[model samples]
Target: MLNGERLTGTGRSKLTAALALAFLGAVTSVSGTSAQSAVPKPGASVFTTDIAPILQAKCEACHRAGSSAPMSLRTYEETRPWARSIKARVSRREMPPWHIDKTVGIQHFKNDISLSDQQIEKIVSWIDAGAPRGDPNDMPPAREWGNGEQWNIGEPDLVVMSPKRVVPAHGPDWWGDLEVDPQLTEDRWIQAIETKPVGVARRVVHHAGTTLIQPDGARESLSEFAVGKYGDIYPEGAGRLLRAGSKISFGVHFHSVGEELPVVIEVGYKLYPRGYVPKHKVTEVNVGVINGHLFDDLDIPANSVTRHEAFAKLEKAARIISYQPHMHIRGKAMTMDAIYPNGQAQTLSSVDRFDFNWHVAYVYDDDYAPLLPAGTILHTVGIHDNTAANRLNPDPNQWVGFGNRTFDDMLQCHVLLYYMDDAEYQQQVAERQAKKKSQTTQNQ
Candidate 1:
């Protein structure tokens, strides 16, 4: 259940959407009667309808013969023993790590693999109830995966590929900043964005991105204000600013993938038409913590448990349509709670575990996901554990802070939002519709 009352800011609902996105796309599911029959009973043939489809739709892409995941769940023989682990992740809403608001209107995420609640129940029940292998005939056909490993959706409108940066096969995992010249964009609003794949010696890449900033030959940027450890959440609390006439360059950070595979990185972004300009320029919000003097730096190690909070007061009220939750390895989870003056705290987003590498923008539904009221106070809380037990932990003993470097940790909830101009926002929607209609008519 929701922990508190509805929030009210000046921009009201507009602020809600923006703040909510600060969280990774994890959601709270409300259940009644347990509906406990979702999982299949044990002692049956786990065929197509029973299990193959689920694995294909959710696991095959990454777990295939030579891929990133640890093991492949391609065949029933391979999946049977590990059914327990699979069911666990699904029950926790972890697999198919998607981060979009499903309660909202008809919206699709650029990168989504989340299973429905019912589906999760089925997997769980099947295991608890004795994973019934229904029948071989019931099993659906297996799918063929491709080497391209592109988005499930084929062919984006535009593809901006970044030049490759080679990392020596052996080392302490080198980190460097590369400047990308976008050929030149005459002011184009990006509609969709992605990171293109480059061959690597190993999956050693930590994180890479296109930070829209001043083209003043800056290799990297610090947060808006670094407030020690606890307040590191708002290092760039106000959001990173992208000035006019600036080039969006790649921020490349990688560790040797595996053995000696050199690292190469590429970026892909699709832009809106030249005429369409969002009222608000690009802004990426980070709502994590900074270490404080009150705590011992050594005690607050990388994977050691820690806490922090931050706030961003909006000057103009605008509704946010989408956002992204991000954190380095040490970060366990995060929440962006909008606290009203009346003490109401509404959950904008809460991601329990964040994957720094696979970050993407998320657009919420129309109704459930909207803006917060103006005058709303966006408070974000971040949790981190800089410890040796952390699988992705780089350095458990080192004191951590917010930065683009690997050793340093971060707590950020970045978002892409637009000003709430009823006329202009709607006009852009209409223009998009008209363009679609005209193109359809011409094709027909």
Candidate 2:
């Protein structure tokens, strides 16, 4: 299962079909039962028929072998021991790892994999009933995983391997840059990219990004990999430019787990051929003011919850694609909104409870994508908790500010967008003005 890909195209159709079938099957089972009937008794038999399907659909993608999850729950034997743990996490709405607040904004998403409240109830009841393994025959057919070490999006046009490096034991976290030549003969537009940590290095690797190294030593991030994200997959007809002769560098941050380790990492890119022009040129903007301004400086006093904000005004009309909120530890919540020139405001995305480890880009569904006029203001609000209640906080007694280190804090609102051309942008501006005039006349 591709956990992080945009849930459109053939994928959504297939999912819809599967869901229809599941609904029909469910209807047959509940035909004789009242809507308010008692919750079904939990047992091993219940585990096989009810609980297992939920796990397969919601949890197994990351919980299986050779994945990011700490344990494999592919079988009854494997999952039996962790029944209570699973119940606790799902009961708290933490397992499926989706952070966006569903009620505050647009409620449609292609990649939402969170469990429903009923599903959570079923799992909790099953665990309370002793997590019995009733029958192997009741298990849903096994799911197939990605081929060994293969990219989930399939074979890439180019692959670059980073030089192997050693991580010292009992040392501070390390940030290293590795330059690898992609040896491309011409420029290409990248559709998707993935980074793989080979050998034992996967355990200690915090995050890695593939960047384009400039002649003057500056670098631009192209793709990234982290704990919960599979890779960078753009929406349909969208891509990022990769220049010819550019050296691909991996900006790797590795955290020490109290042991020395050696590891090798590789990055793979799926590309559009040369001369292939994309419909949308995708770009990401990080909005913030860091020079001690209340909104950008991001100062969080100890034992208090603080909120800061930033704004980005668009010079071109653009379609908003996604928003990825970033913070180290102590991050609590974030909300992003688009303010049109006419003073109308709408929330684009809001994460009420932010998790540093389960970071993901919340991509808008095609029909729900927001188009902003040239002068629209993109505003971001970020909240941080520096109290001791924040378990990940290193020191609640000390104030926190923006920095690269883990103990220090950062608040970033990274928005992905596709800018409209001059003619189309102008047309949109005129249309908006006309609509505003029409509304004012009606009000009068």
Candidate 3:
């Protein structure tokens, strides 16, 4: 999690001008697609048979009424006004809100909602052909969208919710730690888990991570959710253990979007039967340095790109399941490289173009999980562009530092890994302890 308390950066209004340029540029680029005179104009009949179906299948899930999207696109009337915007968005491959660059990294995600290039072309072609009112009959049957009442996956065995917290209409971003008790009398194994935002919070909430607090004041992560993130389901043989008398706490980061928003986030847990035991223990760890001195000194001179590096040495052999690169608006690129003690290096995952709006956790397919051995060093590199050329730059002249605010920046390579068994986990713990003692003895 990015701690805002350590923020060190100058604020400026120059970022506003950059955002304006970005918006105008996007509109101009999309309009250019519509100006292609050589492209034959396909009429309403083409739209009826082709475009309507695509929207129903691909865009309606989020763009429908009562959803997170600002407008409904369920019908022709609802979608007609935003024709140019739709064309622009699809033309840029910015809609559907999926951020994974399919060409790089692992591509097989279960919750991927990205529009194919072919689909994007279809939308653009329809717009160029004068986005017609397609035949009502040709439109596919309206989908029965969920209203947050039912879980996407069946009902959970246990559901815990945070108390209502009001987000101010205009204020600095806020982070809240909500503590709740699950009141379990015995241990349990979590097969899957999900967190849902109630009311307007869905739109304003940025990120949330769940932690389990023990009676002895120790804490461990239970789950984490980013924007557009679906719940997590561990592999059949792996599950997270929850001991009795544990408390669940949610660390929620909220962004203000001009209107007061009320939020009460609810977490649902699907558990295995009481007698079931998992073959492997699933856990998550922050691999790279975050909000530390090295990361905080992120000073990008005007018109210059800054690169920063951090490393995390592994004490155990583990299999990595997923990767999520964390940075602010200025972040241009990020990559995670695994460097072995033998001096061999391999790139685990890389995001060439980081989008502040669409944060995705790239989960590798079962066959492609990276198996990192003990003594491997995870190196993370972050590239930040603070020049005027960056559309999202708030202020290119201002020096940015590690902070929780959106303007302030951070570099975090969040990785999820798990040991093969309890024995392996204990062995890793002991090895780390012994290494720490050895270092202390040498220093003394």
lDDT of each: 0.52, 0.73, 0.71
Steric overlap count per candidate = 68, 3, 2
Which candidate would rank higher by TM-score, 1 or 3? Answer: 3
**Predicted candidate 3 versus true structure: per-residue lDDT over 308-359, tens digit per residue:** 8888877777778778787888888888889987999988777777877556
The candidate scoring highest on TM-score is: 2
- Once fitted onto the true fold, the runs of candidate 1 whose alpha carbons sit more than 4 angstroms away are 1-45, 84-94, 98-112, 125-134, 144-158, 166-176, 198-207, 216-245, 252-264, 275-282, 288-304, 341-343, 355-362, 387-399, 402-404, 421-444
TM-scores, all models, native as reference? 0.64, 0.78, 0.76
Q: Cα miss at 28, model 2 (Å)?
A: 32
Clashing pairs in 2: 44-132, 44-134, 289-296
Instruction: Supply candidate 2's per-residue lDDT for 316.
Output: 83
Positional deviation of 249 in candidate 3, in angstroms?
3.1
- 195-288: candidate 2 lDDT, tens digit per residue: 8787567766777777777545655566766654566678778998777778888878886655688867888889987789898898877766
Task: Mark the 10 consecutive residues where model 3 has the least summed lDDT.
Answer: 1-10
* Model 2 spans with C-alpha error above 4 angstroms: 1-45, 167-185, 199-206, 214-219, 253-261, 289-296, 422-444
